[model samples]
Every structure is written in C-alpha cells, then in structure tokens.
Target chain A: MNSKSKIIPWHSRFDLQGITFLFFLLLCLGSFPALEGSGRDLDYWNNLKGFALKLFPPDFSILRSTLQGIWETIQIASLSTLLASVFSLFLSLGAARTISPLWVVSITRMLLNIIRTIPSLLWAILAVVLVGSNPLAGIIALTFYSTGYLAKFFSEAFESADLKAQHALRGLGADQFQAFQYGLWPNLRPIIWSHCLWMFEYNVRSASIIGYVGAGGIGLHLKLYAESADSWNKFSLVLLCMLIIVTVLDLTGERVRKSIRDRLEGKSSLIKKGD
Target chain B: MRVKNLGICVEGKWLIRNLNFTVRQGEFLAVRGSSGSGKTTLLRVLSGSITPDEGTIEKENLNSNECAMIFQDLQLADGATAITNALSGCLGRNSFLSSFLGFTAQEKKQAIKLLNLLGLSDKLNQWTSTLSRGERQRLAIVRSLFSRPRILLADEPTSSLDEKWAKVSLELIKKDVEGRNGSVICSLHDSHQARDFSNRELFIDSNSPENWSIQDVESKKS
Candidate 1:
C-alpha cells in the first residue's frame, strides 16, 4: 500500500457557517426593535464630529505637563512589570508539573486562572476603590495581571524541556529541584526571558489605560483635559505625545528582544557595535 | 550483583522468565545472543531502568556510589560540550547551585583527566552535536567511569565501532573496570567479540527448551 493513498473517511455532514447563521438570525429577531428610530442621523460619527473638530491644532504650551504624565506612565509600567516578573518566577516553579506535587500544581494553576479572569481594568478599579486614586493602584493591578499571564507561559516552558536530561539527572540521585536547576532551566532560560521582554511591552500600553480609571498616569491627565471643554486642544497634544511614547516603547522593546535573541544565538550585537 | 527469578513482560508477552544471573567484582560477563533474543531487555532490567515483572535484585556489598551505566545511544546532552557532559557525572558531588552555575575548577580538571585517558583530550570542549558515533560512545563510557562506580553496565558498547575502535573501546573498558576494582556486564550480538573479552558467556534461544529436548529424545536412532 502506498502510504500517501490511504483513504480517509469521506462523509462530510454539516458545516459551522450554517449553525452560525441560525444563531445570528435569532439574535437579529431578539434585538430588532431596539435599533428602530436610531437612523444614520443618530450615528456615532455625527455626534462626535463637532467635538473632534475642536481638537485640532493642539496646544504646544502643555508640553511640560504631557511630558511629566508620560514619565509617570513609563515609571508605573516598568515597576509593575519588574514586580510581576519576580512574582511569576517563583509561582511558575510551583505550577511546573515536574518540580511541584500534583496538588500544589493544581491549586496554583487554578488560582492563576482566577487571577487572569479579573481583567486589568477591573483590577485597577478595584484597587482605586480600596487604595484611593493613585499610581500605586495601577502598578499593583498591572503587576498582578502580568504575574498571572507570565506564570502560565513560564510553567509551559518548564514542562516542554527534554525528559532525557531530567531522567539522567534523577538517576544521578539528584532531587526534583536539582534536576530542574541543571536539566530544565538551562534549556528554558532564553525562551522565558524573551517572553518576559514581550510582556513588558504589553504592560506598558496597559499601564497607560489604567490611569483612565482614576489611577494617576498619562490617561488621568488625558481624562482631565477631555472633561474640561476649554482644554480640548491639550487633549490632541497629549494624544500626539502618547503616540510618540508608545512608538518609542515599541522600538525599545524590539531592540531588547533582538539583543537577547542575538546573545542566546551567539550573533554579533549590532547595537553594541554602534555604541 | 545477583538477580533472582527475573522475568520481563511487555504488552502481555513474556520476554524472559525465571532467569537468574550473577556478576562478580573484576569479572567481565558477556550475555551473547542473536538479535531480538532478549539480550538488551535483560541488560536494561539489570541496569534498573526497566523493572522486571518479577525479580529481586540483591547487590552484594554495593554502595550507593558504586553503580554506573553506559546506554546504547550514549545519551549525552547534545546542547553541551563533551567535557561538560562528562563533568555531569560529578553532579552528585556538587551542590545544586554549583552545578547550575557550571562546573567548578576541580570538576573541570577531573573531566579533562578522564577525557585524556579515553584519548578524547583534544575533543574535550567539542559539542556533542559535532561528535562522531564512536567518539560519542567513548564519551559515554568516560562519563560513566568519571563517577568511579564499581559496576559498569554497558549495552553493546562496541556495536557501532569499527574493528580497531571496537578493540580499543573493549580494552579501555576492561582496563578501567579492573583498575577501579569494578565489574562489567555487557550484552553482545556478536559472539566473537564476547569470546575475546569475557571469561564466561550465557546464551538465550527464543524457542522453548523443553520442546527441543523432547524432539531430540524422540528422534534418537539408538
């Protein structure tokens, strides 16, 4: 028998699109009357257009305040990621199936999943309610969120390491933790560091928005400007600043990731050469 | 070392049953058989990687520090260099933190000394991925001996080697085991090689011995 010619089962019954169409039709019937009397005249763009028009020719005089807000946002993001990375490193060990007992792994993974279910914005709001409107609240919320996300990936990296090295180490009378230190960590270090660098970039943007929930940062200032009608020009100026800040963050993150990869793969560092 | 009433089963088929054996200090015991004659399986069971279905392995006067195994595949970590992999045998002696930070000066010196004896001193820092099959096989033996275990169990140590390398490997193995006051139990598909190094040999046939005896008795002309 030619392996390539092996016959598979040929019956193709239903498709997903048919089921999706029925579900969508039911939703249309249920919410049909709610969309009535809300025509093109009541569209979002028509209502938001006048306010948006007043936002152009941004006030450059607010540069100092916007720069201060950007610095505060960067500080919050960097500190949160640092704290979260540390927490995830320890939690991931308990969550790793090879290193941890079954019950411990189960409990840690469950707790992490629950933590992840609470979105960053919700955690920020909860932090504000408990700790008052401060950048500390945003930092705490983002740190917890990043910890939950990073721990999952870290455990997965630990689990995917070669079992032969582990087995050999175990045979040498090394304990579980010893085997992990020698056998798994060396293999997983680069991948884990790369993921952490990527997560730092993600947290930077998320930190910007947490301020909108009254946790003070760039978004807090943005919200204040939007609230006062006279300061609409400052809103555009702050938006432009945010764009520049985000772009710089993105470029810095890219360079950091490349540098890590280059070092791990034994490549010559281009930026290091330039410096 | 002695194995009493040793048996092995895989997927409901018995590979070996009621097989008893012993290996003594300073002895080279060869288990000779054709391919698929339960030779490797018996070696694995002896090595403690594969547990027999029924057996009691009693190591006479064996200390925890006196057992080492060289696998057929060499089992060296490909990501590490030859010296690094060899030094891993001393991992039991070092603290976990020291091993993770790489070998100490003493460990490195010991690894180099062993690799020098194995005629692999020049290849000490060569990555395992770049090693030839025979080089890897020798490295594997060196790795096992680096721990200075009393009993060295090798599964087809010379099977992948050329004639010259094969003889060199077997001679090194005998010399190392004898030097350490250790013993060796090796399985071989080639009886010639087994006869050269080992003082004693055991043969395993796949057919039923009882049925063979019965047929011989019935077919006698006398």
Candidate 2:
C-alpha cells in the first residue's frame, strides 16, 4: 500500500546514436568495392591450396646451395650484432644523461636518432649501392641499424642504473670510464647480455629480407624461386630451411641468456654462503 | 688543513657561509650539528668532493688522493664482493693501468688485513648486499683505510650501529689515524659522544649568528 506513492524515473538514455554511428562506419567501409582483392574469392583459395599441395615434395637438388646461403646469413647477422654491440656500448656512455656532459649527451643522442631514422631494409639498399652485392653489404647495413637501436637501449639501461655507487667512485677521484667499470658495469651486465641476445635474434630475421636487395643471404634464392611460377617446391625448401634456422637461433639465444643469469646469480649466492 | 672564508651554496641556498677552521695533524675534530645543518656538506667540501663557492682550502701535505671520505649512506657496490668493494679505495692511489688490471697480491693482502681487523674476515668474498647493516658500515671503514689517507672525512660512520659497535668503530678509526699521524673530522649528532671520542668539537647552527665555531672539549672539561 505504501509503494503506490512511489514513481520510477528513467534517467539513462539509450545508445542508439552511438550504435548507428558504428553501423554507418562499417557500411562506408564495405562500400569500397575496389579494395576487395581476388584473394577473397573461392577460386583464389583453391589455387592457393593446390600450390601449397605441390610444395609437399621439395627439390633436394639445391640443398647444398641453400645450406651455404643459410650459413652466410648467420655469419652476416652474428658479425653485425657483435660489432654493433661494442660500438653502442661506447656511444651509450656519452648518451647517458647522468654520466656524461650535456653537450656530449646531446650530440650522441642526435647521432643515434639520425642513424635510426633509416630502416634496416633501406640501409641495406644504400649499402648495396655503395659496397656492391656482397655479404659485406648486408653486414654493414645490419651493423649501422643495430648500432642505433642498441645505443638507445643501452642508454636507457644506464639511465636506470643506481648512481650512488657511481657518485661514490667519482668522489674517490675515478675518471668517468673507471667509475662506470667499477660501479655501473656489474649492475648492467645482465641487462646488456639480454639486449645483445634480442638484437642477435632480430638480426637473424632481418638478414633474410636484406638478401632480397642483393645483399647476399638466403632471400636471394627465395627471390629467384619466387620469379618462377613452378618453382614453389624450391621456395618451400628455402622457407623450411629459414624456419629451422630461426627456431635453432631462438633456442640458442634463450639458453645463453639463461646461463648468463644463472652464472651471475650463482656467484652472488656463493658469496652469501661465505657469510 | 686550513679553510678560510669557505662558503657552500646548493641551489641558491647557503648551506655554509664564510666558514673558517684549521684541522691540525693528529687532531680528531668532531663536527656536531642537528639534522640539515650542513655537516655532511662541510665534510664533502673538506674532502674536495664539492668545490666551495668562495675562499680556498690549504692542506699542508695532503693532495686530493690523500683524503678519503666515508659517506653517510655507505656507498658500497652491492653486486661486488666485500673484498672487491674494499679494494676500490686503492683505485684513487693506483695508476690507471694497475687499477684496470685489478689489485696486486700485496694490495689484496692489505685489504684482507683491514677487513679482518674490522671483524669481517669471514665475509671476505661475501656480496655486500648480503652483509648486515653493521657489517656494511664496517666494510666502508675498511675501504677508506685502504688509501692510507692523511685526512679522513667520516659522515655519521657509526649511525647505524649499536652503542658497543659504535665505540668499536670510532676506536678503530682513531687508532688507524693516530698511528699514521693523520687527522679525522667526523660528524656526530650526539654531543656527549662527540666530546668523549674527539679532543675538539666544532658546532654548527644554521639559525645562529655564528654559523660555526670550534671548542676544545678537553680544555672546557679541564
């Protein structure tokens, strides 16, 4: 009987306008008929299936050449990553804001930015034009690219490191390099290894595409096979080789990173036991 | 060491203004101040870590290398072994090449002996992070001794220790410097303890007209 005096007010509005706006957006997108490619059709799917089926039996004739290409690619990536990491290590000291002078930090940062503005693929193209079509071109391109990337990463690492120890070392009259070696290096060792491994993994992947620009690697073989419509079997074999190499590299990188961490932790714990 | 018209300003605020004092050789001068009275700043300036805004400091036989400071925070590298951290004090005295190659056999032996004297013999290879706070403070003292400093600037070196340990730490520092005819200028919050440990005391008051003045506690007591 008391509820009879009460009235419910509906203050919430329906979202009809928002729903309509979304619907209109979808309708406008669907109206662009020219954007639809043949790949969306049944015939395209059937053709792709047949082509994939034909790749089941790969040609073993080019196995030797494929293996050689894989090895060359590995060499290019590994050497480039190694050299880049070292150069970046030195540059990052100047890039770190807390550790370096203002002018040095600004200049190093500008240089890194300029280098990173160019993509690795474009860098490879530039290297090819300058150095000719060789593994050296690929390596040089990767080195330049990796240097910018690793320098930025390392500067961030240095910035994140604790500066109390560095300050103390400086108070003890240590130069910048010595202070970094005794104070910051130990804290940054694990991070440096992780970043290097990640860069190596990235280099390995990018090494494949760099070969398309005539910087020697397995992508050169892939390009040749791609040009011939019936050479899907060879293309598939090359793809398979790339898959195996990438998987192996990923596994190796993980193992190495883990081992480094374990070794550092083990040494720490061993010292703790002495107490 | 003589300081004349020494002034230190941090970010436009004068922490120490026109401070003048002389620390004689073989003198144990205790600096007493309340919190935020610039005791640590004065020690830093004395140790040449911070350049004073005005005036100059003249040392009779001490170079920058001949002075070592035990920071209030005890800045030991946590990732390093206790021995390694202790050995870093020698870096200032050694040539760059020798420091790069690491401690020599004799240097290592000396570091071990210092650590042992501080009762940290069992923790020679221990990571500094794993050591207790008292142990870390002891390690800091040992590290400062490695340089055989002619003048030692200690900023609250015994703050983290109990009464017994504080006395031990102060005694150890006193013994080391007395034997070498060196001097120690340490900051202490406890005035009584300062009087007990040091022959002379320097009092700093940020709010007082005389910002700093020295008193011979022994003379006053006598």
Candidate 3:
C-alpha cells in the first residue's frame, strides 16, 4: 500500500515495527558466541559423562530418610501456604482501589511488588541468616514470597469482581469487611482455592531447594550427598523421589481445580441447587 | 425520608438542582421522568452510593442499613447462587462471620419462602448469571425486601419483567412497604403504573431549570 492510497507506512522497512523486529533479532544473536564457548573444553565433556555414569544403581538405603524429608517439605509448604492465604486475603482487601484509600492501596501494592521482586531462594538464604537453618526458615521464606504473589492475584480478583454488587452492599450499610465478605468473596472463593492449591504445589518444590541452604527438606540430603565422596547415586535417588511427589501433587491439584470449577458452576454447592 | 434542596452536577452541567421531596411512612412514592433525567442519579444519591454536589436527606438519623435500593441494573452477584444472593440482604443486620459461615437458619427459610413466592423455587441453586432478565429482577426484589429496609428506593425495577411479573413484583413491594409502615421511592416510565401503585408522583426533568416537582397520587387506583 502506497502513502497516497491512504495506507501510510511510516518510512517502510525502517518503521517502528521493523526497528523493533531488528532490535529483537540483534538480542537473539547476543548469546550465540558465549553459548559456543560452553562446549569448547573436552575435559568438561568427559567430566559430565563421568558424572552421569556415577548417578546409577538406586540407593535404597536412604529411601526411608528421604521420605521423612519429603514429608517435612510438604509440611513446610502447607503451613506457609495457610499463613500466606490469610495474610494475602486481608492485604488484597485493603489493596482494592475501589474501596480502600488511595494512599493505602499504593503503599500495600508497592510493598507486595518489592517482596515479589526478590526470589524465593534468596529469601530462604535470608531466613537462614535470621532463623538459622531449619524448617522454620523454609516456612518464612515461602510465606513472604507466596504472600507477594497471592496478594497480587487476590487484589486483581477483587478489582475485577462485580463492582455493582459491591456498591449495592455498601449502599445497604455493610462495612468494608462485610462488603468484601458478601460482595467479592463469593466470586473469589473458587479462584482463591485454585490459587492457593497451585501455590502450595509450587512451595513444595521451592521447599526442597531451600533445604540446600539448611532450610530443612530433601535438598539438604542432596547437599550432603554432594559434600560426601561420590554419593551422586543417592542424590539422583532423592531427585527421583521429589519427581514422583511433585507429579502426584500436580495431578491431584488438577483434579482439585476441576472440582472447584464444578462446584462454582453450581453442580454441588454448600447451598445445593439440588443439581 | 425528606430530601432538601438536593442538586447534583456532572461534567459542569447541572443534572438536578434544588430538588425537594418528602416520603411519609407507608407511602409508595412513584418517580416519573424521561430518559437521562437524573432519576437514577437521584435514587443513587438517596441510597448513599453517590454523594450529591448539594443537598441533604433527613432520614430521621437512619443509617444505610435501614435503607435499601433496588438498582436499575439489579446488581445481583452474578457468580453466586440465587439463594446466596438472596441471603446477602441480611448483610446489614448480620455480622461478617455470619455471612461468611452462611446466614442464619431463619434467614435461609425466609429467603427460600420469598424465592418460592416469586416463582423462583427451582432456581435457588442456580447462578444469577444463568437466570433470565425477569427472574433476576424478581431476585433483586427479594434481596431488597429481605433486608426489610424502612425506605426502598427502586429505579425502574420492572423494566425487564413481563406484564404479569411486573404486577406481581410491584404488588410485593407495596405489601412489604405497607406491612412495615415503611416507604418506597420507585421510578417508572408508565404513568399508569405510577398512578396505580403509588401514593405520590415525582417528575424529574434534568434539561430544564426547575428540574423536579412532586404531587399526590390516588392510592391503589387500579
């Protein structure tokens, strides 16, 4: 299309879209030469092969202890998720711009953003410094990180809920808490359950990793396996155990999320519609 | 409830100016106005959702819990069950914990009875989103009446209803207001409806300088 025909192409190929494509293309090539250096050393390849070879013959001896650690990780995720759910619900309530004061919403949202900006692993290390390498450390780190995400999710959910319903509730003299309870909470209930379940599953994975820093989980066992002489077999076994557990949780979470949807759609509610 | 010198302006244009009205106990005050005449805005201000630029409502120191508005759009919680939506009317009297746990057994029974009365017995468990427009309108009526408000401010409530349901719903409103010795300020497009059910008629004309006026209507003319 020519400019005179009313299809104005802003300088053809070097326009904004083309410039953006070119910029991305250059960035795409940025990692090429550095990535090429990764396979340059033959010795490193041999060591990797050797490392792979050592992770064989499942170590059944530590299976019981590994299961115990797995249980601890589950506990850590559950506790932190419970705490985070309560904290985030209230925070999100206050963060709802349509109800709460602007200054309060801004401060709470900025605080949540700052919390989310820090990685969970770094939070674990920080907690280890504060609480000194225990399950409590894992709980604290995951709670802080999960609160950040859940608050953001819940606030957006609250904002998107039926505004007219909220106004009606307020018009009837329901206070902020009551308004949230009746107005937004019913719609958000299913979503909150789904979000919390997903977060719990995620925290379980993070719990295992944070244990490497002595925060208490199966990852601590993996760390010890690395420190000891050629215990890569046990390390691989621990990873296999985590894989099984995470897979089970992921599948179960899917079913749970499905059930929540069914319930919300009125298949079977507490106040059953007789369906 | 008495509205005194009420005026509301939007976008530097006066929608209502120096409006005055009084609603006595057990009175059904029908508000008549053409489209975009600030009738809804007047009700919104009465319901305390929109603060007027100027004026005051003397509700004898009555708070919002004692007043309810049936919105033009209904504003029922669409994602919730019909029963849940009906029970929401109790939010004014019940605690947040009670609402969270669910309303009291009596509230549930009353809600069920009202739902049945409105021919919504089978829809108790249905989501509000699935209900037809007329059913939802009746549901909004149930919710408003469940609160037992001293003053019910309905804005074109029967717009979506069939002629039959419209009469049934309006009759319910009239019965509820008179039973409690309360008052209703309802807006309507049909002068026949305004005269049939209400004891007073109020016309708000936003385009003119003298925006609002009220006169008495014969009670139960139909």
**Which structure among the candidates has the greatest TM-score?**
3
| lDDT order of candidates, top first | 3, 2, 1
Residue-wise C-alpha lDDT for candidate 1, range B4-95, written one tens digit per residue: 87777767767677777677688887776667767778777776778889877888887554677778776666545677778777766667
Q: Identify the superior model by DockQ, candidate 1 or candidate 2.
A: 2
For candidate 3, the per-residue lDDT at A134 reads 94
CA lDDT of every candidate? 0.76, 0.85, 0.86
Candidate 1 structure quality by residue, lDDT tens digits, A139-222: 888989999999999888877766776566656555667666655554566678878878877887887788899776898988
Looking at model 3, residue A87 earns an lDDT score of 99
Tens digit per residue, CA lDDT, model 3, B92-187:
898777666767788899999989888999889877766788999999999999988999999999999888888888999999877999999999
- After superposing candidate 2, which stretches have Cα over 4 Å from the reference? A1-35, A38-40, A43-68, A93-110, A130-132, A157-164, A175-177, A187-190, A224-275, B4-20, B53-56, B77-81, B119-135, B162-168, B190-196, B209-222
Better of 1 and 3 by TM-score: 3
Query: What pairs collide in candidate 2?
Result: none
- Evaluate model 1: give its TM-score: 0.73
Q: Encode model 3's per-residue lDDT on A67-120: one tens digit a residue.
A: 999999999999999999999988997887965799999999999999999999
Model 2 quality (TM-score): 0.77
Candidate 3 residue spans exceeding 4 A from truth: A1-21, A38-63, A90-110, A159-161, A224-236, A254-275, B3-8, B14-21, B51-57, B60-63, B78-80, B94-102, B125-132, B190-195, B204-222
